[model samples]
Target chain A: MRTSIIGIYEDEKVLMDAFNRLQSEGITIADVLSPIPLHGVWEKLKLTTRLPLATFLYGAFGAIATFGFLYWTSVVSYPLKFGGKPLNTLSFIIIMFVLTINIGTLFTFITYFIREKMYPGKKVELAVPRTTDDQFTIVIERPHNMSAEEQKKINTLLKETGAVDIIESNN
Target chain B: MYNTRVRGILIKGNKSFSDVSRDIIKPMDDKTPLWWYISAFIASALLIWGVWGFYNTITVGIGTWGLNNNVAWGWAIINFVWWIGIGHAGTAFSIFLLIVRQKWRTSINRAAEAMTIFAVMAAGLFPLIHMGRIWDGFFIFPYWNTRGPLWDNFNSPLFWDVVAISTYFMASFVFWYIGMIPDFATIRERTASAVKKKIYGVLSFGWIGNAKGWLRFETAAILLGGMAAPLVVSVHSIVSMDFAVSVVPGWHTTIFPPYFVVGAIFSGFGMVLTLMIVMRKLYRFKDYVTDGHLDAIARILTFMSLIMGTAYLTELFMAWYSGSEYELFTFMKNRVTGEYKFAYWTMLICNGMIPQLFWFKAIRKNITIVFIISIFINIGMWFERYVIVVTSLSRDFLPSSWATYEPTITEIAVYSGTMGLFILGVLMFFRFVPTIAISEVKGVLKETSTLKSFTDEN
Candidate 1:
């Protein structure tokens, strides 16, 4: 069985400094929970993000598809002449622009949901009740091979890094 | 390196993160305030009365309105334009400010976005009922049907309006709901009641704030903001085309698109200011929706009023320069000197002149004066729509066709009802949710920490 140590931080500055010190000391961080996102923490944690590119692709696809729909419907599908205006005018371009943006934004949201593993009735393990309100929490899972001395050293390091409180639980 | 006076400090000084959370969340968790109840009651009464009016209007047919053959479009279109114009500032606050990286928008965007949704709801009702055949409203959308299935006229600006307004509503609604999920999670965590917790949990979609989650959320928000920014311009432009495409003298002009867009933003700000001033005071959110926000909005209003004044001048200049008798009469005689002259001058004074007072720093800062000016601007915007729709149509080319248009009791009741409905929506938002974004305010507190200290270490 492996045990995990949780540290609750009051200030974001303390949390970031602790994460850096732990990383330098070759301690692995399993997870961090925060009420609001910490700036630059993702880059520091070396997290890879494909959301930007994916959203961009979605936007491009949306724009092309919307433009195609408008063109196909207005110009080819059902063509009509009114007020002697051309079948294809610049006005429908406005409709296409709105639809492109709408679909693109909507798809980006769906991608976010999938990436976050968020959905209705999904079970979430809350580290602490206050984690979503005011507290910043970091979880450090003890490795199976870690010795007693190494575990003691990590405990001292967490305290030294200004953790407001610490809890250890077996998983 | 930071100013001691808190130049751009969104949350007030001397408040910690917990304090920010408590201040914002307290309103939601605590008992509903007496004022909120009173306001909601009034709105409900008005809404009920307006429903009665709407029912009467439907059953009695179009005869309930004073729309004669000449002045076919009256209070319904005017109210529609007014409410839709008010909704513009919400998207402008959330999307435009986000793209521009205006950090201060964090405080007001949530409520402003709510205002957008409610105002759109109010505006949308007018057009459906204006049809006099509200049941056939679905015919407006392009859909396949069994009968010869008459397709929508894509060229007609009215059809364009249906598409544009509906798109604006959906986009704004989605944007508003998604942004609230994180906050909903916070509320879900903090609340003691099991039912409330469960409801909020579902609404939040099990949001567990992690670095990866935030990264994706930020990317999505920025993309959505980019998409919504153009909508603020395009929606109003399409709505203006509804009038511009017509051959009516006052309504038809190339400048209507830009003119209406600017006017929509201006009126939208006016309504936002009116709501925010009261909200900041009632909700005790003075710390978040600070004086700096008011000053910034006032300055924007003043600048918008200046452009609106210029646009008005351009219209007059074009009317004179066109050398067309109808355009000249619509601008010079019927609008300025004829029966609807009161409305015309009121629009000029309210929309064009009153907002200039905001140019003065003292007036902009004075809450009382700002409130008064906002009311004036709101009145002026309604009158502007009225002057355009009524005066232009009332007196056409032939004098025999000229007839004065007067709104009946039913029209007035319906308009007032929409007002109540808008207020009711705002009240419900205040009671159910944190009027300010709690997480964003904490973020601002971090960003503004430099203002509290003179240290260069940060």
Candidate 2:
């Protein structure tokens, strides 16, 4: 029920030293948050979620909405003849294509939200102000198998690495 | 080193945070002056009268305008294009500059963007007002009205205008609102009043100082910028299609789409310059809106003018070289020399001629010269549309249908009203939100090149 929380200092050398120490201690990190993306954190963390895939899917959803809405409005809604053109000119594919493209773009925005788990009304849980202005942060969720003493040791290890400060979680 | 010029140009006026807050907030124009409320009321009254005038036109028939068989597209079309053209500067400031990394945009981007929203509101109103039945304007397109009064012609470019303009509005609004959040938070922090603090605080959306919010906000900002850039381009291109897709001699040129797009930017930037000049003077944000911005925008205006010049020449060549009598006559008789010939020459002399001065650093940097030239640019853009719509329609393929175009009194007043509306939107917005993005300005200060290198060592 106890987890070994670890915080690594944002300084490049200090962060690298802490990374080596963590690997040496066999402590696996859950996630890292930096003000900006660090140079090698992606490679070190092995994070493999395809946010782009989610984005692509959301894009398709938006396109479908656009196409479906336009089609519905055209065929089912106020249908009248202009230029004596048929309801489904099929030649009008270009307009639909552009509309779908615009809509898909509109939808791709949603993926950014889902990826961050943030929305307009969602509660913001920004722990450190400097992360936006100055600092980089690395967070590792403690493993369930870790003992209370092991968790304490991990905190001590983070403190030793010049983490600046540590945030401990019950999880 | 030259690349950092825009950044340096942006941050050079190092008056502190409080100075910015005060400069941006202080009412420079005597607010208690009767004219502030009087002008607002007069503009509002004009707006009401314009709306009533439009209502009368619509209630009577589309026939109320001077638009007839010969001049089928008149003031509404002209107004639509004008509003759409005005709409361009906002996204250009909000997206294009952000992409090009012109940090100087942070100062006037908010105001220019607010202009865009109101301009769109004015622009989008025309089609519906022109539709005759304000209640059933939806019938113009096969959109959402299940009664099936008329099916939308997919081939018509106007349909695309609705889609493009609406999409642009929504995208720009998102871009505007997302950009506003951090600034809103800054305002919330700066304001002492509990009501404003609560209002802005709630709008900032529970932004607890977290790395997660920072990460998401950054992604959203960049992504929105990217989204806005394309939307801006596409919107104008779509607007251009309203003419390019047509077969009416001068209006039907393949050159029109991109040509109009460039013209939109030219005019839009001119308006932006006019605005910044006024704002910098009035709000005492002289530090934020500097001479460098005027010079840089003048350069862009010059570049756009050159593109539009080529487009004009190519259009003429294509008309002549294609060996079509109608096309040749359209260009030779009307566009170059006809009843509207004066306006055509005026456009060339203003949009095409005045911009050439921008090649000189002195004129480009000279605020007074730039301001005057931008006014000319705006006039030229309006004349450009006037030439395109009126002259093109006034004389079509059939000689029997030919007639001179003129705006009804209603048309003139409504346009004046819309301009008033546009000015009012900006004037009112400053009363609500701080003109410049203070947090963004502060953030830029922190990222000043001199300090950035040390952070790397840390």
Best candidate, lDDT:
1
| lDDT of candidate 1 over B36-104, digit per residue (tens) | 888888999999889988998898898999999899999999999999999999998778877767777
**Each candidate: how many clashes?**
0, 11
Runs off by more than 4 Å, candidate 2: A1-53, A64-93, A105-171, B1-7, B15-42, B140-151, B447-458
Fnat values, one per model, are 0.60, 0.22
lDDT of 2 by residue, A55-155 (tens): 45655766676567656656677455567777656535545555554554566555655665545554443454444323445567766576888777777
Candidate 1: segments with Cα more than 4 A from true spot: A1-3, A169-171, B1-7, B147-149, B449-458
TM-score of each: 0.95, 0.80
TM-score of predicted chain B versus true chain B for each candidate: 0.96, 0.91
Docking class of 1: medium
Candidate 2's error at B150, in angstroms?
6.7
Model 1 clash pairs are none
